[model samples]
Target chain A: MSSFFLFVLTTLTVLMLVYLYRVVRGPTAFDRVLGLNGISTKAIVLLVVIGTTFDRVDMFVDISTGYALLNLVGALAIAKFLEERGEERQ
Target chain B: MTFEFPLLVLLIMTAAGAIVVKDLISAVFILGSYSFALALVWALLGAVDVAFVEAVVGAGLATVFFLLTLFRMAEKDTQIRRPPVPWIAFVALPLLAILLLYGAGDLPAFGDPLSPASTHISPEYLENSVEQTRTPNTVTAVLMDYRALDTLVETIVIFTAGIACALILRRGT
Candidate 1:
């Protein structure tokens, strides 16, 4: 509620935008992956804040947890799959 | 004016960023972030039950699946290119969002006490569901029981997504 929190949130949005730009414009495969991972971690915090704002703490918490799991698993799977392919050709 | 604006702004920003990004991996991550932001917004709005579901499925499992597909997709060729023009997604998305927002105008106000959500069957479920179903949250009871058939179908859908992903990856291998 305080201006300080607002400032922090605003700063996050700005940072997120910067990252998005990289993901969109990056010329390589890995760079985009890195950018996306960064964005996802930031999102966890954002979700809780939204829940608090709306007084939907109970529902949002569960959703946040699920989202966290999805990001983690999805990242690892992609990483593993890519690694395996690279190894096979070599 | 307070928390909701911050939350909504975050969600839209992430959503826009996800679609506009060209790098598939980055786009996936943005999607995850978008999901997380949406979950947080859900929690803040007193939809803890919904938040819990979204957090687990959308943020957790969905991200994992996306990464899996991305990894499987990486081939001998390493170059990833933009689709010549991503400006289109940016322009078109806002228009879609506005149209959706207009549709949303018919919906009830956020957390409106007198809304159907607070009245109708919800109140009854809230009051007696704990004792009747041995569940602390009526929402869970409703999801698990009252809507048992639909939930079963949804579970099947999740399973199908996993299977389909595996099948697709297997083919490339």
Candidate 2:
């Protein structure tokens, strides 16, 4: 079971590399923001997996819940900034 | 160990890309990705408490702060340029990297039972944490109970940072 979780973790890390490509060569800020969002979502899952592996799912779940909220805050903040930036440009 | 090496490399790559990217917004987003990768690495290292903190502050608050800074700066100021390669940076960076790598070689292997950290205070903390603090999570117990003063001081420092940022950002033409 741990090995299966470890496999999932490895797969997620590889997916992060794909997201990294989007961040590095993104054509626009929006693309980078989306990539960041994807990475954060994956990280939340990874946190859960880590907790399960350690047999501390309840504790890790609390952390991940906070993480999800913060992720939302970060994404909203960036979106707001870009919206303001666009207004300024116009 | 097998998991750690690749994650570390990814962290380095994302951090480097964050600095190297041309656009400020893209750089900020990439920096978030870098933080996320680092949090994963910390979780894998069996430091879930640190990992949680990193996820919140590194991936969350720090990215927002970076974006806010970018937005506040004038448009021209945000255009990060690839400056003429500084001779000092070139020479210094490689030396620093080599020094760090050499240092890593001397550190105890990952999760080694005889490592200094595992053999020292860790056992005492683990064995007595529940009895002392009645908290299942020793990390929390240590921070909030055993070392409450330290946590208080850190909270004050973070409060100060928030105030400083607000003051600086509020000052304007």
Which candidate leads the pack in DockQ?
Answer: 2
Question: What alpha-carbon RMSD in Å does predicted model 1 have with respect to the real structure?
Answer: 4.9
lDDT of 2 by residue, B91-119 (tens): 99999999999999999986788999999
What ranges in model 2 sit over 4 Å off? B86-95, B171-173
TM-score of chain A of each: 0.77, 0.93
Clashes per candidate (backbone, < 3 Å)? 46, 0
TM-score per prediction, in order, is: 0.68, 0.89
**B61-127: candidate 1 lDDT, tens digit per residue:** 6767666655655543223565566788889989999999999999998768799878888788888
Candidate achieving the largest lDDT? 2
- Return the lDDT, model 2, position B141: 87
lDDT of 1 by residue, A1-90 (tens): 656556666666666667666666667655666776776666666665555655666655665576567667666766775677668879
iRMSD (Å), candidate 1: 3.7
